[model samples]
Target chain A: MLNIKNLHVKLEDEDKQILKGVDLTVPAGEVHAIMGPNGSGKSTLSYVLSGRDGYEVTEGEASLYDHDLLDMEPEERAAAGLFLAFQYPVEIPGVGNLTFLRTAVNAQRKARGEEELSSGEFLKLVREKAKTLQIDAEMLKRPVNVGFSGGEKKRNEILQMAMLEPKMCILDETDSGLDVDAMRLVAEGVNALRSPERSFLVITHYQRLLDHIKPDVVHIMSNGRIIKTGGPELALEVEKNGYGDLLAEVG
Target chain B: MADTAVLAAQTVAAKARPAGTALAARLAELDLPTGGFTRAARADAAARLEAMGLPGARDEYWRYTDPAPFNAPTADALAYTDRESTLFGGIDRLKLVFVDGRFDASASDALEGEGLEITTLAAADAAGDHWAADLYGKLEASGQKPVKRPFAVLNTLAAVDGVLIRVTGKVSRPVHVMYRRVALDADVTVHHVVRLEEGSELTLLETGGIGARSNVAMEVELGREARFHHIASKRADDAKVGIGHVFARVGEGALFKSFTLSVNGSMMRNEGVIEIVGDDAVAHIAAAVLGDGGEGRFHHDDTVFITHAAERCESRQVYKKVLKNGAHGIFQGKILVKPGAQKTDGYQISQGLLLDEGSQFLAKPELEIYADDVKCSHGSTTGALDETAMFYLRSRGVPKEQAVVLLVLSFLADALDEIEDDRLRGDILTRLDEWLTSRASA
Candidate 1:
């Protein structure tokens, strides 16, 4: 479960307040999509939730499974089962992808009082998980995100999500760089990981991604707050007409 | 480019300090070992060294690292118990052990092997006709014209007997030279000569340092079509001061590659001069250095000069240094393309990683091209760890220090990747990792 009560955030290097009094809640085993136009703080929400630097929370109370997310360090939040699929995956030269994956998997496990997996077991698990994402062995051997195509980077992000198996997954602009086929593959990967104990908060601009991975609830975010909460059909209405009508109506 | 004038002025202003007096006293107290030809060579070098004097603060070449520690009358050698017995203990090879700069016959293997002629400098001194007769102290004298390395000449003049190696055929196993110090306040000098005949190959591996203040001079000659690989690890206790010099001559179509890896020392310098004399020859000199961020004042310097004399020759120089805490690192490398050396290919890169704000790195990269048709490039960079990359790794659940280790290893990979031998590379990498782990714990 994830909870947020009037989350406010601002750019640390500038005097600009990006998020102002946003309230949202997603219960267990549910998928919520926040659809917003450009400059509506969609990306800032994900970055703040993932504990990125240069962003100060002016006032907010956010929690994941009764653990105060704001008080924990980034790695601690990750160990608490909070995962953020970055909009742009960082390219880490000289660090093999497999090594990155293993270190992350083991680090989270170790922080959570779980025994680390052996190299053999980890390799076997990764291969099996990667098989469904269509990521070949060579892709796993190269450095992280170095020279990977856009689609390949998205798939690798999904592969990482599958490996970490976090309880709360936040997908930020995942569909922005993906083509139709790539979007389908990413959606399939996300859909396969959905379970009773896991939840997702998908943030996107268009309904194209929603058509593949259906969300149980849709929230219309404007400026910095949620203006409306509706069912799946609200997406189609905005898809046919644009957010122009919705913004006028909310005003 | 000369520092003698500056040193002379300083001596005048300072009212005749011990700089000259101490050097004269030290040289007068010691006598060159008895060897007819090598003694003659030592006499020539001794006079040259006396003229050059010991390096001082005014010396251009010793600008970043002070030479005061090396000028001591005697160095206090630290007793060592190698955390690991030998550097390349996993592989079977010819292992030569030295204690306090003297060859340890009881701990060394036999002096002969198939396709290899190995003898001590003491034995070679008594013999009139030997393989190293022409090589002994020859390269040192030749390397002195462009640069004045008085310490190298000092090493040649006052050496305590080293090994002479002659390779006539392929040598599959590496010859590892192990140096360990057991006495305190011990100063030792050694000179080694290695000759690889035409079409022959040899790999030399060295680890550890000799006295508290030690000077080691190594000369290598690769004949036509021959290949020589040299890898040395300079490791000293927290209090030791050591310097190593390597002079190599590459013949026609010959290949010479040398790499030095350094882990901490109070004061340390590794200088190399590589000459490509014959056409189509290739020589590469690289080094990877690490110094701790501690109170011991870790200072490291790597000075390299690579000359391309013949047509179509290739030369490469790569130096990587990592300084943490209050450590200081210096790199000075130059690639020279002679007038007639057309179509020469030269590449030089020097990089430094400073772990903290207090650490410092000084790099000087040079390229001299007299030929019209040549391709030469040089670059130098000094930077801290990438905070974004660090965050990415930490966001993925890796801890902070481990992330640093990853990035540091990546920074050094460009230089470490130059090693062609897989097993040796792996061993050196392990040593690097060990250095990282130890520093982290400290």
Candidate 2:
């Protein structure tokens, strides 16, 4: 469902390259895990796919279902079924969480040539989805992520993913700040949405998240390139003997 | 030494002479009303205006906002766009319509209601004895100290029409003052006086444009334990130049809240001066302004001064402005606590969201506390939209324009929150959304 080939990116304001020529693809219905250390360009690849600013693509191409993701705006990419779960969800003061969710859901639907949901229909749908994520009425009423805890922010991201129901999801370090229980809850939420037509590219620094939502494949990314790809046991090897062993072996 | 002193005196006189001449020239352009109950107040106001001598560019209060537009002798002609007035349409109200600063009795509702007494300023001035006579310009005059507001003085002296409302008990329906301008070059001034007696409650709503160039003044007096709410929305007339002044005196245990929303205007200035004289009183003044200079020269200013003179009084000032395309916004707010006014609580915040680099926001926030036991805090911020927040919204599938509108509304929510009534607040929000949406498409 998602493809990236030789994607090279550099900081727009600086001459330093971030994502060197590196690529990996995740097919439909597959949950792929990307494990890497700091400054490995795993997050950069996700950002490039989601159409974030402050990055210049010097070379290579990334597409979703054969649609050029680089040429589309962030909103357009979102309407094209691309979703990124931010590590640090933005704190938007004054825009209520429910309002943001409703606007986003309706916006994507409208962009995709679908009828907008009425307020009642939206309230009901959101309540049902929020019930599973344990997000209460007060959290939905408050401004988006303004005072949310780290775990709540991650769960809120999952809620957005569920609401949008995108074809391809990119989880960029969603488990970074979450506790064990929170991570399990979030993983459960993600696992529930897994389907034959959906795909996920979970990016993380640790293998703990994979224990909750099992991945079909694991890739060790380092130096802006995926150096190794294997089964779930590859994550176990890395967890047993960190990326230090893998990097040295690959070199 | 003697020569130096003489030079200083000569400099002071040199400055006064031209100011005097300019004030006289501007006064010559006004046809002041004569032989009425307000004649004495008007004459006093004129004397005060002469002493202050139209606010100059170098004046401290006028530094951020030029007073030239309001001081002009003639108003430029502007076509009065004919459209149905839609604001506050769903609310059942006692409608009072004014056209070109003249009260249109035929178009307005009957001036009598339960526990309410309303009259035109002209009629009140004509009568020998009326309760409004005591409050004609008393608050405006009292608010003149510590600062000079010559335009308010000018408005009091040159006002052609206004409404005088006195509420003795709870008023179920709001008094809606709707203004419409028909004359292209109408130079209009209106002075509205509201008096809420002890234990009384009332809501006053004002909307629309008075003229091409307008000066509007409102004096409000809240008696002991009285509650008063005032909300106003300026007509989105791109060519209009309007200055609005509100002077209020809140009494013991009384609650006074006033909020204003301005969507458009070439040059607009709103001044609010409130004095909490009695103990345990509460007062709040807020404004939400949106300006797009692409339409014309949009310069909007909100100047507020709140005085806490009684023990245990509370006051809040909230002003927010959203500007784009080279628009300029100015906020000058001050909180003053007098001696013996212990336990005084005062808060003030003024923020501006500039949508583009060309737009600018200037703010001057001040607090003077003579009482050591007072709690007074003020904050001012001016910045562009948070790019991280913008991306978060857009990435969620909201279009860039829709994201901007959402962010702008979010920036204005605090100011809009000052309106207590849900229906009134909803109406303002709807109007604000409409304004932002139209600009987004444009």
Candidate 3:
């Protein structure tokens, strides 16, 4: 469902390349976990795929279901079934969470030539989804991510991903700064949304999250390029051996 | 035949009087005592206004707001007439009506609440009970030229009959004063004095009615431990114009709050002067001006004086304006502290949101202090709605107009939240929504 061939991304107006000639692909019905140390360009790849501002694709062709992903706007990419769970979500004051979610869902729906959801229908769906994520109905009425705890913010991101039901989901450090219980809840939420046609790219620094949402393939990234690819056992190897050996091997 | 001649002569005499002379004549007829005071005080106040004159476009304080209309030669002289009654949309509260420069007893309702005394300054002056007189015209000579606004001068020179409200100790019920302007093409001016005694609490809601043109000035005195909540809403006819000034003195351990909402007017100016004179006193002044079309050419000037005469006084001023069409809005606020006024806290903020390209706004917030142990801060912001926020909402399937309305309403909700009265807040919000809806349709 997703493919990246020798992806080369660089910071705008700079000589340094963050993602240098990296290759990866995730087929339908698979979850791929990418683990690496700091400065491994994990976030840059997500940003480049999500079409965020100020990230230039120096030389790469990223395709999501045969459509060029880098050419679309952020909202267009979102409508094209691309969802990025931000590590630090932006706090939008005075914008209700339900309102934001409804907007996102409707945008994608409208782009797909589907009927827009009325307020009543939207509220009903939101309530049902919120219940599943342990998010109270009252929290949906508050400003998006405003005054939300660290755990609640992560859960809220997951809730949005579930509502949109995107085909390609990128979780950027979803387990960072989360407690054990919150991590379990997040993993459960993500697991419930898995399907045969859907794919996910889970980015993390620790292998603990992989225990709940086990990935089909584990890849170690060092200095932008994928160094090694293996099965779930690769995560345990990184957890015990650290990235020092992986960096030496990649170089 | 003799009666006809006498009537004709009276008419000729009234016509021959100079512009604003009728108001001056009426002032002379009211047998009210000049509150016994030093001549120097009154002279000083008169000198300051004379020096300042009517603020024109050249004055920095009145640059964006022009007060020249009040001084125009085409303005009609003040005259009383028996006109149809004005309605306040069925508010069942105390009402005080003023026509031209005098009180209209036939238009006023009776006050029946305990711990409340509502009467004319003329009657109080006749009985030698001069509480209102002593407090009246005192702010003019307070040596603060900034507070000596041109409208206050006009009210001082032409005021005839004024309303005096006295809330006795520990009263809870509110006093509602309705200032109705009925004269068209004529200059009508009024002066009002309100006193809240020690340990008393009162809410005063003043509404300005439709008229040709009017000028009003009021002085409020709060006693020790007293609390005053004032709400003023003014809606004028499209052709009508007005200038209003309110001066308040808050005593030690007292709390004073004023909320002004100006929705409709061709040209209007609301000047507020609040003084915290005693220790532990609090003064909160907030205003919202919503203007649309070419009619809403409104300006507000809020001047706050925190003397810190005792210690630990607090003062706050907040002003928000929403401008549409070719309408213009202005907000000028100042916070002042005297020497040795320790532990004083003063905050002032003025913000405006322009809805259209033709709409304009000017905000100026200033702070002047002599004490070092005081906390004083002032900030002002004027800008259009965020285009990014608008597009974000639009991309979500919300209509463009509805998105703009929601953003504008949210911008104003912060100010409206400060209003403690739910009914009043609801009324204002409804009016605002209606105005925004109509504008969208137009």
Candidate 4:
């Protein structure tokens, strides 16, 4: 469902490169986890896929379901069923969380030429989805991510994912700042939404998240390139040992 | 100090002989009602206005916004209110309507209700011994020492239609005064006075433009343990120029809260002066202004002065301005603590959102404290929209215009929070949304 080939990305405001000749792909009905050390350009890969600004894609080919993703804006990508759960969800004061979710859901629906949900329908859907993430009514009423705990923020991200129901989901460091119990809950939310029509590209530095949300394939990235690709057992090997052994082998 | 007081008294006394100006001449020529206490007050105020004349560009206070519109001949009435946006919908309240600056008695509801009494100013020549007589111009006169506000005096002198409301008990419903200009070239002036007795409460709401060139004043007095809430909205048309002044005083243990919303107008100047005269009094004055640049470069100004004269009193001034294109906004807020006014708590904040490169905001926040034990803080800020927040919203599939509107409303949420009534606050917010929507299209 997602494809990337020889992606060369550079910082727009600087002369430095972030992703150099990187390539990876994850088909439908599968979860791919990319393991990398700090400064290995894992986060940059996720950002470029989501169409974030300030990254100059000098040369690349990225697509979703045979559509040219690199040619679309961020919102256009979202309308085309691409969702990115931010590692640090922004705190937006004065914008009610439920209201924001409803706007987003209806906005995508309208963009897709589908019928928009009424207020009543939206509220019911949000409540039902929030129940699974332990998000109370009060949380839905407050400003988005304002005064939210770390785990609660992650759970909110999952709730948005469920409501939007994007075909291609990119979880950028979803395990960051999450405890064991919180990680388990998030993984459960992700696992429940997994189906043949949906795919996930989970980026993380640790194997703990992969333990909960099991990936079908594992890739190790270093020096701006995906240097190794293997089965899920590669993640366990990296967990037992560190990326040091894998990097040495690649060298 | 004595020299200053003598000079002020002499100036007030010298108002008997007037200086020359076209505005003063026109005011003098009006066939005004005469031979009463109100008449005497009007004459004295007219003299003061004549002495001050119309402020010009050289005046320090009028440097930012030109008062030429206020000085020129009255403008022809605008036909813009046709199918204009409405406010206070679905709310049952006492409604008063005025047409072309005259009280449309047939269109207005009754003037008397439980615990509230209202009398028309046109009938003041016939009425006797009213309670509003003593406090009508008192606060306005008291606020004249440090800064000069001849506009209030001009409004007092020239206004032909208004009301005096007295509340003795808790008012069940608010009173809304609606102004509609049907006549072309209508130069309207109105002076409203409100007095809330001890332990009483009242809510007053005003909407619509008074005239093309309007001078208006409102005097409010809160007695011991009383509460008064006031909200006025000026959605002036493009060619309109209005100068409005409000003078208020709070008594012992009383609360007075007011908010002003301005959506349009080529030139609109709103001045408010409030004094907390008794211990434990609480007062908050807030405003939200939106200016869409017009041919005249849309100018809006808010000048506010709040004084804590008694021990343990608290006051807050919050003002927010949203300007687009070449719109100009100015804010001048001051908080003063009198001697021996210990434990005074005063907070003032003024913020401006300059939506484009040409839009400009000017703010001057001041605080004067004579009491050593007082706590006073004031701040002012002007900035563009947060780019990060904008991107965050846009990435969520919201259109760029809708995202900007959301951010704008979020910026105004705090000022709107000062409104105590939920339904009224919501109505104003809806009006703000409509204004933003229209401006976005423009």
Candidate 5:
């Protein structure tokens, strides 16, 4: 469902290259794990695909279900079924969490030329989904991520993903600041949303998260390129021996 | 020493001569109303105005705000628009309508109500020795120390119409004063006096400007254990000039709260002076201002001063402004704690959210505490919207314009929170949302 080929990106304000000729794709109904070392351009790929600013696409292309993601604005990309779970969710004071979620849901639906949900319908739907994520009414009423803990933020992101139901999801380091229990809860939430038409690109530095949400493919990215691709066993090998041995073997 | 003293005296006279002449020229262009009970107060204000002269750009408080528009001989005319105003429409209130500063009895409710008495200034003057005679301009005169407000003095002298209200018990309904303009070049002046007796309560609502240029003043007196709430809204009308003043005195255990929402205009200046004289009194003054200069020159100024003279009194001042397209906003706020007034608490905050680089905000916050045990704090900030937050909203499929409006409303929530009534706050929020949505499309 997602495709990238020879993607090269550079900082808009500087000449330094971030993602250089790296490429990987996730087919429908499959979860792909990208295990990378520090500064290996894993997060850059997600940002480029989600159409963030401060990045210039120097070469190559990225697409979601035949739609050119690079040419669309961030909101349009969102409407085109591209979602990125940010590493650090923004804290917006004065905007209630529920209000933000409702606005986003209605906005995306309107962009897709669908009928908007009534307030009652929206409340019922959000309550059902939030029940599974363990988000209470108080959390929904507070300002967006203003005082949320790490686990709550991740769960909130998952709730948004469920609400939008995007076709392709990119999780960039979702397990960085979360405890083991928190990571398991997040994994369960992601697992519940998995379907035949939905695809996931899980970017991580460790294999603990992959243990909960099993992936069909594992790719090791380094120096802005995916140099190795294998089955689920690849994650185990990396966990046993770090990227240093892998880099040596590849070289 | 004698030579220096003579030189200083000559310099002061030399300065007063020019301002006195300018004040005369301005007063010559208008007619001062004459009445029975207000005659003494009017003459006293006129004399004080003549001595103080009209405010000029050179004045300390007028540095950021230009006084030329207010001191001009004739007000600039604006093209009238027929947009219907929905301010306070959802509330059950006693409606008092004014057409170009003249009271329209046909559009107003009956002057008699439970727990309160209302009368026009003209009618009260027709009756000899009215209760309003004691409060007409007393608070205003008392507020003219340590600073000079020539425009408020002029408003007292030349006001052509007004309302006088006295509350004696808990009021169930609010008194709403709606101003409508029918002439393009109408210059209107109005004064309102409100007195709340011991253990009484009242809420006052006001909306719209009187004309192309308006000079308005309100004086409030709160007795012991009384409560008073005031909310005012000025709609978006280009090429309009307004100058308003509110002088209030709070007694023991009394509560006083006032909030204003002002939209686009050519120029506006709102001044508030509040004195907490009795122990355990509370007072709060706040405003939410929005300005866009694309239509015309938009300059808004909010100046406030609060004095705490009794033990354990609390006072707060909150002002927030959002400006874009080269608009300008200014705020000057001060809090004072007198000696022996221990346990006094004062808080002040003023902030400006600029939508673009062209807009500007200027603020001056001051605090003077003569009591060693008093607590006073002040803060001011001016900045653009948070870019990271904007991206977060847009990335969630919200349009850029809609995201901006949401962020702006969030920025203004603090000032709007000062409104103690839920319904009143909701009405103001709805109005602000509508204004922002319409402007985004425009």
Candidate 6:
């Protein structure tokens, strides 16, 4: 469903390359856990795939469902079934969360020629999904992430994903700044949305988030490339032995 | 140099004119009350006004707005005979009409509501009402200095008949005073006095009609525990020129709110002076000015003086201006706190958004503090729309103009949200939306 063949991305201003040659392929019905240390191009991969501005794709191609991903805008990519759960979501003041979410959902639906959801039906669906994530109803009425705590912001991202229901989601550091309970609730929400035709790439620095959402394949990314791919046992190995050993081996 | 030569020639022509001299002579011929205690006050005010004169472009406060063209001598004071109905329908109340500085009795509607006393300022003065003295020329004598505001001084000097409405006690219904001006090429002065007695509450809606070139002034006094809400909407045609001033005083534990909305005019200067004279007094002043066309110039100056003479007084001022085409807009707001006025809270914000390249806006927010323990902040910002936000909205397939409209509407929603009256807020939003849409289409 998602393929990145030797994707090379460099900073726009400087010639410094963040992603030199990344190769990853995630098929349908499987969750891929990409664990890496800081500065390992983990979040860079997600941003490049999500089509954020200022990130130049120097070489190589990224395709999602046989369509060129790099050529599409961020909203177009979102409409084409590509979702990126941002590590730090932008705080948009004066725009309510429900209004923003409904706008995004309706934009995508209109692009797909689907009927728009009425206010009543949308509220019902949002309420049901919000229950699994432990999000309060009052949070939806506030400005988007204006005063939300770090954990609440992350859960709100997941709620958006559930509403959009994209074919592939790139969760970047979704476990950062979350308490144990919040992490469990977030992972449960992600687990419930998993399906045979949907895929998820859960990027994190710790193996603790993987305990809740079990991944079929675990990859160790070091210095812009995935150096090791193994079964779920590899995550346990890295948890016991640290990424320091893996870094030396990969280098 | 050529412009200065042309201006000198015009000044010479104005000075050599028989009609202009006659008008100026008639200004002296008018019997201005100068006998009682109010006479001394009016004499002092007139002398001050003569010294100040009209503001010029060189003045920093009046840089964007020049009041020279409006300073010409007045024409004959035509008795306003016919008052067209209210421009904004759905309003049912007594309407007072003024033309060329004279109140037209035939154009005014008599009041029949209970607990409401609506009478002319001249009548109130003749009756020797003690409350009349509390507000007549009160702002001119005691409020902020009009040393640089020549029009304010002129209004004081040429003051004539005005509407005085007093809510005896707590009143349930609102009092609408529609002051319509229907004469051109004439200098009109209106002095409105609104006295809200102790524990009284009322809403005063004042609308200035089209086709009037005048200098208007008003003074309001709120008694203890009294609540007063004043909303003024001015829509002048291209030929009209006006200078409007409002002075309000709030007693202990009283609340005063005033909003000024100006849309169409050739040249306009609106000033609001709100002084919190007693403890726990609250004052809120807001204004929105929308100017279009090269010939239209609208200026607003708001001065809020919180004496803090008593403790725990709060004052706020918000002013916004939207300029299009070659129009000019200005907003100047100042907040002052006296010495020993402890626990005084004051905030002032002035923002302007210019739509056309040739359009300009000047915003000045000043804070003067003498109190040691007080919370006061003032800020001013002038800029165009946010490019990034506009691009984001347009990228969603929304048209360019529609996206701009949405962003501008959102920009104003913050200030409009502060309005508590649903009907007033809705009316303002509807008018604003219509103006924005028409501008976008044009």
Cα deviation at A119, candidate 2, in Å, is 2.8
Chain B TM-score for each model? 0.93, 0.94, 0.81, 0.92, 0.94, 0.83
lDDT (Cα, tens digit) per residue for candidate 4, span B1-442: 3233223323443443365555545454444444244655665665666567667778877878887777664564655655433788578889888776778889889998889989777666455456667866667777776788877866666667788899999996999888877665677778888999999999999887577777778899999999999988888562278888888999999999999888867888899899899999999999999888854558899999998899999999999999987999999899989899999999999999999989999998999999999899999999999876776666677767777888888888778989989999989988988878776756
Candidate 4: docking tier: medium
lDDT against the true structure, per candidate, is 0.84, 0.89, 0.72, 0.83, 0.89, 0.72
Off by over 4 Å in 1: A220-224, A232-245, A248-251, B1-22, B29-31, B77-85, B236-239
Model 4 ranges off by over 4 Å: A236-241, A248-251, B1-35, B126-128, B236-239, B294-296
Per-residue lDDT tens digits of candidate 1, residues B124-195? 776556768788878998998788897898787778689999999999888988877777656878889999
Best-matching candidate per DockQ: 2
The candidate, 3 or 4, that scores higher on lDDT is 4
> Which scores higher on lDDT, 2 or 3?
2
Q: Least accurate stretch of 10 residues (summed lDDT) in model 5 chain B?
A: B1-10
Candidate 6, residue B419: CA error in Å? Answer: 1.8
**lDDT (Cα, 0-100) at A187 in candidate 6:** 90
How well is each residue in A1-251 modelled by candidate 3, as lDDT tens digits? 88999999988877778999889999988999999989989988988887765667889789889779888766777777888888877666656688678867886788778998999998888888888899998889888788998899999988898888888999999998899999999999999999998999999999999999999999898889999999999999999999888788776
How does candidate 4 fare on TM-score? Answer: 0.93
Q: Residue-pair clashes per candidate, as listed?
A: 2, 0, 0, 1, 0, 0
lDDT score, candidate 3: 0.72
Q: Can you tell me which runs of candidate 2 are displaced by over 4 Å? A: B1-20
Model 4 CA lDDT for position B413: 78
Residue A163, model 2: lDDT of 92
lDDT of 3 at A100: 75
- Worst 10-residue lDDT window for candidate 3 chain A reads A87-96
For model 6, residues A90-151, the per-residue Cα lDDT tens digits are: 56565668876777777778777799889998999999888888888899988777799988
Order of candidate numbers by DockQ, starting with the best: 2, 5, 1, 4, 3, 6
Pairs of colliding residues, candidate 2? none
Give lDDT: candidate 1, residue B108: 90
